[model samples]
Target: MSDLITVEIPLGERSYNVVIGPEALMTVSPLVAEMMQRGRAIIVTDEIVAQHHLAGVKTLLTAQGLTVETITMPPGETSKSFAGLEGVVSRLLDLNVDRNETIIALGGGVIGDLAGFAAAVTKRGVNFIQIPTTLLSQVDSSVGGKTGINTGHGKNFVGAFHQPRMVVADLGLLTTLPDRELLSGYAEIVKAALIDDARLFDSLEKIGVQVFDSRALSQAIAAAVAFKARIVAEDEQERGRRALLNLGHTFGHAFEAEAPKDVIRHGEAVAAGMALAFEYSVQLGVCPAEDAARVIAHLDDIGLPSEAGKLAHTQWDARRLVARMRDDKKNQDGRITLILARGIGNAYIETNVDEEDLVAFLETKLK
Candidate 1:
């Protein structure tokens, strides 16, 4: 009957459920109602989402007899910065939220990330839920317990590991996502696929998408979550296997932080980073030239940019970008480690990656 699949993120005391498919948004209240401890619920969303799905979220929660408060945020990733996080915290204080109250993050990655962080720090810690509205949030950011605000220092530079009580990822909400945002989210799918499943990459090669449909999205989201959940189960603190999830994020973050963040979205920059990684994989003789071409081809087919202006070629301001790299929690013993692939679905962690070698690779291959 239904084409949706659900995956459970198992973390013992921090365990949670990830609900997928078209009926998800409507099912949100009930799904969360079971997990919540009869506590007050605050739904935090962005203005764009408020215009589209906020009413439905409010109505469903109200129908459940839950005391709900709606806090709408200004749109965009800047909302994931320290200032925006502070604003939400202030509002929660204004509402006088108790320690047991739950914060429902009801929009995209920005809202999920920023609101989750607020819930993490408010009065020390409180319960929170994720209703990731966009493709990026649902399949990637929302499922991960990592929550944070970007600093002038770097992307997701300041953050916490406060997991959500539950995640309701309704593919129906993604129907309204802008084409670019859809492609942006797909980058994570590709990242996850390239690391763990060649079959998933083969599916992307066949689909060649610019926008997402609910049928296809339900599969992609479940696959990403399955791999991420497996990694999280083994290494919740990202001390090991989970590093594979960041296959392209190291380069992606350097570019995200190096460029003017206002212009480049996080997922957009990640697309560029994945492309660069593809090229580096080839240079290392780990991947065939054709495989490298396929990576760029798929990204372009999905309306994701393969190259950016300031961050594209040249040396990537190695000092500035690498400075941020050192700040990554993945850094081990003063060395920056990263995940690189030999080919699609053949990723491996390389702890011995030299800075000059990485920088040189970025300059020539990325160029």
Candidate 2:
């Protein structure tokens, strides 16, 4: 096993450590035992992950004298919904879960969001741990406490700010992920670098997608997690600077809301969104064209969708996409809130954006 890199999210009493490295699943048993000395554990996973790591994890915990129960949901974004939440919560209730027992999320973003949200509402918020399996979940969703399901209005519109008790990001689990899924997660890593760590972005530029198959994977994941931990610690509720973390999310969510089911992955939408953000920033005369070009080039080289038009199996409409953006959770007083960049690693929240200009810019991109 490689050396572990622990990133601390200092949220006072609600604080937790994100243990990142190969074979990090070994840490979950000890952490669970420490958290609930007497209560059994409930692992909320998806059908896909249950087939991969569920048996090993369950056995590992049971061996440590911890009683374990499992709830396996269907895979994909459809699982992140009211129906999904109700199913998980109902099972927890049926199992007579107590406030002391912990909910363990054992899959990717969908499982984490669904399980975390279930923990937040079950018994008025029980403790939960995140054992994210995918690259997207490891670097993005697993670290932050943001939990929720998607709504017809927009993605993540209905969710809670419930932090987990701990996050165990096992790099070894990523080995089982398909290349497309791995690339999807890479978008979030790129977003982190675009938000506030130009140095990390530079490293990615030099390393390219090889980061997924090399020692640099650990460093990239740690850097993204550390960046998010700092942002989350400062603004746990996203009241201020933490909004930077949503650099490409606003645009990304709109793409997601409009795209058909299973048509695009969250990370792919985010990749396109980040590209749109940089291009939009350039259009608004805030970010340099060269910077936007570099971002697009990097995304293209990685085979990620850099524009809505570039996304397969969908015809993007500027007005419809803009309508989805208007419903974004970040918007305030009917004005769209966007994270625009002046250049790489210089993202900022911009709330005074003109809707007409946005529509016009999106129209050009669609063409």
Candidate 3:
């Protein structure tokens, strides 16, 4: 028997299920049918995913009598753009994708964010299902209601809080992921563990990067999703506890925006960002220096970048990077909101980040 797990995001009426496992994709059609009685679906995927899973997705939905149409975009971070959003919106309109029908985001985080934002704005909003293929999307982006695109200013700078009707994360699909991409996804699982679950972090340390083993992978994914499910249920709009999910994101996003687009992927930046967050916490006299070192060592053991200097195509400019963080959505009244840690598995939101201190910390990392 296959190991299948489902985590429910208890959001009253807007609540949904994150179904994980090898057979998770099979559940998408029925879930979409329940959400959209018309049995119509327009799949939004990238060219790469289309080559791999688009046909199977069509077959699944078609078996359920759902009329399926697909729109393919070029794969990469560049696809998360105003132009990409506009293109998706236009295609849905052309296909007569009414509000009652559904949009299935059938790729990684990029597809989920772009397609989800399209579903949010089109005809005022439409039902959508998330079929996140990559491990990063599976454990993090797909579960949250965060849907957005990037602008020249920064990553995920433009977007919405629209949740999906269902999230189908087929772990089997991850078997085909490139090793680099797979490690990138592992960074999110590590983030989740560091944010709230010390036990999880301990298990990961013991397991090393062999987390791809069937039992280990399933457990890690379930644990990560469960952690996120609880946080999202408590603070759907990122009002409080939810912000903890962005522990490394604030610094990570700044670096990501400054680095070359095609280079460091989101999770890679996050790995570096997380290390920076821990190191910065030590500088703030918050997290223990030993804790920060432990976290960095684990990330390095897994082949993830633990330092900003290691990132490719990065300009390593502290001032410009800090400028990018100023545009982060978490900021309020010009104060940078950061997710810091007291130690491993104990992250919190700190809104009053001192700019001078932050710049100094970044300066050390730049060179």
Which candidate tops lDDT?
A: 2
Query: All candidates' TM-scores?
Result: 0.91, 0.96, 0.95
Once model 2 is optimally superposed onto the true structure by TM-score, how far is the C-alpha of residue 4 displaced, in angstroms?
Answer: 1.1
lDDT agreement with native, every candidate: 0.80, 0.88, 0.87
The sequence of per-residue lDDT tens digits that candidate 2 reaches over residues 245-303 is 88888888888778777788889998999999999999888999999999999999988
Deviation (Å) of 108 in candidate 2: 1.0
lDDT tens digits by residue: candidate 1, 155-233: 6878899999889888878778777678778888888888889998898789776226667778878988898899899
Ordering by TM-score: 2, 3, 1
Best by TM-score: 2
Q: Please report the TM-score between candidate 1 and the true structure.
A: 0.91
Candidate ordering by lDDT (highest first): 2, 3, 1
Candidate 3's TM-score reads: 0.95
Off by over 4 Å in 2: none
In candidate 2 the C-alpha lDDT for residue 136 amounts to 95
